[model samples]
Target: MTDHVDVLIVGAGLSGIGAAYRLQTMCKGKTYTILESRSASGGTWDLFRYPGIRSDSDMYTLSYPFKPWTHGNAIADGEDIRRYIHETAHENKIDQHIRFGHRVTRASWSSEEALWTIEATNDERPVVITASFLFLCSGYYNYDAGFTPEFPGLEDFQGEVVHPQFWTDDVDYDDKEVVVIGSGATAITLIPSMADRTKHLTMLQRSPSYIISLPQDDPIASFLRKVLPLGLAHRLTRRKNAALAIGFYVFAQRFPRLASRLLIGAARKRLPDDLDPRHLTPDYNPWDQRLCIVPNSDLFRTIRHGKASIVTDHVAQFTKTGIDLESGDHLPADLVITATGLQVVAFGQIEMDVDGEKVDPHEKYVYKGMMFSGLPNFAWCVGYTNASWTLRADLTMQYVCRLINHMDANGYAFGMPDPTGAEGESAPLLNLQSGYIKRVAGMLPQQGSNSPWTIRQNWFLDSRDSRRADLDEAMVWTVRKPVAVAG
Candidate 1:
């Protein structure tokens, strides 16, 4: 027997939950079931557990409009963020709709039946679910595993190798020498916290990242969160922070070299005298890959205090004793934590097909950076690539509600993106690229050649078009039924 639902949401991440919440509240009398691949909620927060794993963007803008975050630091730690997600699920009463450990492997559209056939497995037991609408909320982050480099002589390594995602409670670096790999946010976050316990910490990277320093705590943000109620505080903070982020994103995009140089200059001032600027510099501009945010230069302060060191060189190989650098040096480590980035898996690696034909998503244009081409009754909650994810995701959620209300008024069952089959149009709202965003750029929806749905990556535009704009024929995917027979 197959269970019937109005909407089948995949992956219980921020986006997935957001979609579910919107549908639950707005879609009167519609039944929706959310399938989470994992046994728990909190998607990325539930997945990654390495030391100091946290949000790079400020918490105010990173959180949803319906849900708010209260933390001393605007950039929250993983634990705090996780707590917020759990609380939101519980408070919103959305937990009952989610089935844990139910991984959706494949879904096919049955046009004849006007339903989606979703095949999912929980603990190796397969279950069939049917739904009228399919919302792919599974975020772009890899849920399967992380990328760990195959160093030479790995079998002979004496120390333990740890990954951030599967990190356990037992990884105590207390008085031990720890070496963390990768220059991404994970590594930068791990350094300070790990340094507090480890005798010494070493950050190993082949090339340096464009790292910027923000306050460990935002005074205004923290105060606002305390002074006002959650809803108002979150809204005000989101607007204020969004304006700042948009200004920075615009400046960086318009003046790439100048922005890069200014960031490089800021980084240079925080390093030791012996460090070479070029060795620690990057070939791409800031946010080209992703810029790392630090808590009041904690990583820099630790490096200056001699508790940690940043080594710039390629990893040649690994020995039984330690890691061998291309510079002909070996750094002995008691514990090696691989802060290596996650292996990105789009839509949880699920295959989508319509009546036995495979849907090559990359070839299709994203309608508004969420839904696919000509696939009505479906909406996705994918976020922006340039700025904070929730900035775009929150907007997408709001848009979904607006669309749902419009469809409900017209007595419609579905709404899909109109197919124009445009080229290079589906590319990201941002010109820059990251591993995950790059892979799915053309595969997602297109906004326009430029903002809201085009190249305008501004949160304000997303707010206006997605939330407040008129959805009159131009910006919405809508469907309605024919007039019924008169009495």
Candidate 2:
């Protein structure tokens, strides 16, 4: 049986739920349904079951603007975030519109029909659905497995191996020495989280990344919540946090040397006397890649208390007992945790075709960081690389709502972004130097150097521009045809 709706939203995570809420509130009377591949909601939160799973960004900006985050902790745990999403869906009755365990595989758009035929699977059973518009809220990463680089002599390791993405309870770490590879957010988070329980924990990294310490709870937010109304407090706190985040990013980009010195100095102060400051310093400047945030200096505290340590060196090979370093240093471990990185996937790897022509995302230019050039009635929610994800996500959702309303008002069948005269050198859609992003840069869409086609990561600019955006500019729209009625 085939089901049809005005809009079909893919994924039921943070972005998906937010998208649904925006569509319902802004575009009233528009029928929409959410198709989630996972059995439950909470995309990243539900997928990752690591030891110290928490959000890198503050909750205020990470959460939806309409639904105020009531949690006192600015850095929220994965479970807390999962529950919050579930609550939001339930509260707004969005849960009823979600079909869980529905993995969307293919989407074909037909110009003649002015509709998209979606193919999905539920419990290995094929299912078909159609929608006038398609919104991909599925995140950028591969859900099936995280990226793990092949280590030499990995099979010779006697200890149990695990990736933080697929962490299981049965993998015992208590009283066992653990070695975690990679210097990314996951490695930083896991070091402190598993330190107390493990006999000893070592963060092994080939190169250092900028790390900063932040308070788990925001004092200003707490005070505002106590003195002002809930909604007002949330808005104020969200704005303040967003400003700080954006300001820091701007500062780093403009004055990289100053930013690097400050970051290294801060880390130097937090480091133990025995540990060298060089281990905390990165060759790259701040915001070149993402800076790791350690709540309340927990990772530093863990090191200072003799629970954990950091090792900056190249892994020569994995030995039977542990890992051998290129510098002739050996680190013994009972378990190895590969906190490597994520495997980025474009549009959830969903095969898309328009009029039987297979759509190659790489060949197209991104329109305003959401829609693709020449793609009709389609938008993908891509978050910011330098700031809180929800900041860009909210903007994209709002613009989508406005675009849909514009089409409905004009009696248009579909709207496509045309990049014929857009003048600019094409660049990678995501403006980040992160390893994961660089690895899959060619697989994603390209962004032009000019407006509409360019993806400016600035929230202030994007928010303002999105509001006053010309709907007709560089857009191709078709009038809705009259439906034939039998006399």
Alpha-carbon error at 26 in model 1, in Å? 2.3
- In candidate 1, what residue range of length 10 has the lowest lDDT sum? 472-481
Which digits, one per residue and each the tens of the lDDT, describe model 1 over residues 80-142?
888888888788788988999998988888766667899999999999999888888887656
Mind giving the per-residue lDDT tens digits that candidate 2 earns over 1-487?
6899999999999999999999999999999999999999999999999888999999999998998999989999999999999999999999999999999999999999999999999999999999999999998999998998989999999999999999987889999989999999999999888888899999999899999999999999999999999999999999999899999999999999999999988888887777887688898889989988999999888988989888999999999999999999999999999988999999899999998999998988888889988789999998998899999999999999999999999999998998352565788888888899999999998888888788887888888888898988789998999989999
- Backbone clashes counted, model 2: 0
Q: Rate the local accuracy (lDDT) of all candidates.
A: 0.76, 0.92
Considering only N, C-alpha and C atoms within 3 Å, which residue pairs clash in candidate 2?
A: none
Model 1 Cα shift for residue 200 (angstroms): 2.3
User: Which residue runs does candidate 1 get wrong by more than 4 Å?
Assistant: 225-230, 423-431, 435-455, 468-487
- Those runs of model 2 whose alpha carbons end farther than 4 Å from true positions after fitting are 419-422, 485-487
